[model samples]
Target: MASFFAALMNSLDIALLLFIIAIGLNIVFGVLHVINFAHGAIYMLGAYAGYSCMAMLGLPFWLALIVAPVPVVLLAIVIERLVLSRIYDRDVADSLLLTFALMLILNESIRMVWGTGIYVIDPPAMLQGTVTLFGNVTYPKYSMFVIVMGMLVLAGLWWMFNRTRVGHIIRAAAIDREMSQLVCINTRFVITAVFAFGAWLAAVGGVVAAPMRAIDPGMGDKIIIESFIIVVIGGLGNFTGTLLGAIILGLIHGFGSRYFPEVNLLLPFIGMALVLLFKPYGLMGSGGR
Candidate 1:
């Protein structure tokens, strides 16, 4: 029973980490209608940046976590203004191609800078210990920290989307860009802001994940596939759906690996296929723009 509880805690950790990455993908798709193929690269950049700050500069983990994502967020703003802005209304294929190209460029650039080696960041000293749960079972404090951070992020996102004026404006733009423009909403600015915000979120996820996962050039590629799956399964353009999808996928990854190892790798895709077959628009997706 204790072992089962430990597994459940681990599953929650995975789900929360996924939510951090997948929510950003959902928001970008929800508002900008672009697939953001470079998102995973941005995530990788965040991880590397955090790694450098902590390992080389001798900064504390907390400081690295706070400072590492800023540059990536700025890069996103620049990319939005310079590249993505040009493809806003073009065919989806065009945006996909452009972002795919951007992804390749970013991936190569990361290799150039980071030397294509696998790196690992140690969890903060405060999070290094294990907590005794029931009798003999133990759980890492770092996992608990991750779960807490994920919940905080979830709440923060909820407040940003539902309570703030900017959130309302963003939702309006997502719902009807033309109508928003007619009402004097500068949707161009909103789109750029949304893109940057999404990128920032992805970067934060990367930083959070770095201590837990091996960092390498290939990390971005792996995450992009899973991130894309999460966004699609949750319903494109649906933030709430992204959360649900991330949790479900996280659980599948965690429990499936333990209980159904033979087919674990294929389970998420199977679930995606099933969801698409029945809902077509995704669990929370709406028809049309």
Candidate 2:
């Protein structure tokens, strides 16, 4: 019983992390209609940047968490303006190819800068210990911090999408790009900003994940596959769907690995296949506009 509760808590943490990454993907797709292959690289950069700030510059973990993702966000903006903008009206296949090339370039660049090695960050002293739950199960305090941060991000994103003027602009663009432009919304600017925001979210996920997992050049590869699965299952370009998808995948991974170890690796893809078959647009996805 205790073990089950511990696993459940851990699963929730993993799910939250997935949510962070997948939500960004959903937003970019939702607004710009571009599937950013470089998102995973942005995530990797976030982890390395946080690692450098903490290890090389001697910054506090909390401070690194705050500052590490800024440069990536800036880079994302630059890329959107200089490169992604050119492909906006191109075929989806063209955008995918271009972005995949960018992904390779970014991954190689990270290897050159950070070296091809695995790195890990230690949790801050305050979050270093564990708390006992349900009599005997112990859970990491850092995991709890991650879960809290994830919830805060979800709340913040929801407010941004539903309450703010910028949110309204983004929503407008997502609903109908040409219509938004006709109404005098600078959709070009909105697209760039939305892509940058997505990169920012991915970077934050990387920073948060750095302490929880091994960080290497290839770490992004693993998460990107999972992230794609989340977005696809949740519904492309649907924020609420991304959240639901992430939680479902998280729970699947959590219990599947524990209870059905032999087939754990195949379960997510199987579930995705099923979702695609039954509800081609995704469980929560409305028909594409």
Candidate 3:
């Protein structure tokens, strides 16, 4: 029972982290109808930016956590304007190819700039220790922080989409771009904003993950596949579906790594395949954008 509980906690943590990382990809797809292949690159850049803030700029971890995503958010905005915008009217394949190219460019660019070596970041001082649960069971404080932050992010995103005017505009634009344009909704602006916001969320995940994982140029490539699975298994462009998909994948990872070590890496993909075979759209997904 205790072991099950531990696995549950670990799975939940992984689920939350995956949610934070993949939510942006869904959002961009939801609004822009463009699946961003470079989302992971932006996430990788965020971790590197956090490292830079702490290592080179002499910023504190907390400050770095807050500020590290800014540049990446801006980069997303620029990418949307300079690259994605031009292809908005083209076929979906166009955006995918462009984003794939962008991802490749970012991977090499980051390697050229930050070197091909892997880097790690230390967790904030306040999150350095462990918290005991009951009868010798303890949990890492940083892991707890990740879970809490993920909940907060979930709540914040809910409020942003449900309660805010911008959220309403986003939904409207997403539901009907041509009609939204006719109704005077700046769909162009909304698409750019959503893309940038999604980038911001991805970077935030990267910053949070810096302390937990080794930061490297290859990090994005590894995560992109997982993110794709999460998005697909949850239903492309479906917010709630993404959450459920992340949790399912997280559970698969946690238990599979422990009990089926050799197959751990393949579990999520297997789950993805099952979802595709059974539901095609995902457990919570209705369809693509």
Clashes of each: 1, 0, 0
Q: Stretches of candidate 2 above 4 Å error?
A: none
lDDT of 2 by residue, 1-289 (tens): 8768877987898899999998998899888888888889999999999999999999999999889999999999989989999988889999899989999999999999999989989999999999887888888999999999999999999998889998999999998989998999998888888998999999999999999999999998888889999988889998888999999899888888888899999999999999999998898888773
TM-score of 1: 0.96
Candidate 1 lDDT score relative to the true structure: 0.89
The C-alpha stretches of model 3 lying farther than 4 A from their native spots are: none
Backbone clash tally for model 1? 1
**Number of the top-ranking candidate, with lDDT as the measure:** 2
Could you tell me which 10 consecutive residues in candidate 3 have the lowest summed lDDT?
Answer: 1-10
Pairs that clash in candidate 2: none
Comparing 1 and 3 on lDDT, the stronger one:
3
Residue-by-residue lDDT tens digits, candidate 1, 1-289: 8757876888899989888988887789889989889999999999999998998999998998889999999999999999998998899999899999999999999999989889999999999989887778788899989999999999998998899998999999998999999999999999988998888888889989998999999999989988888877878888888888888788888788888899999999999999989988778788564
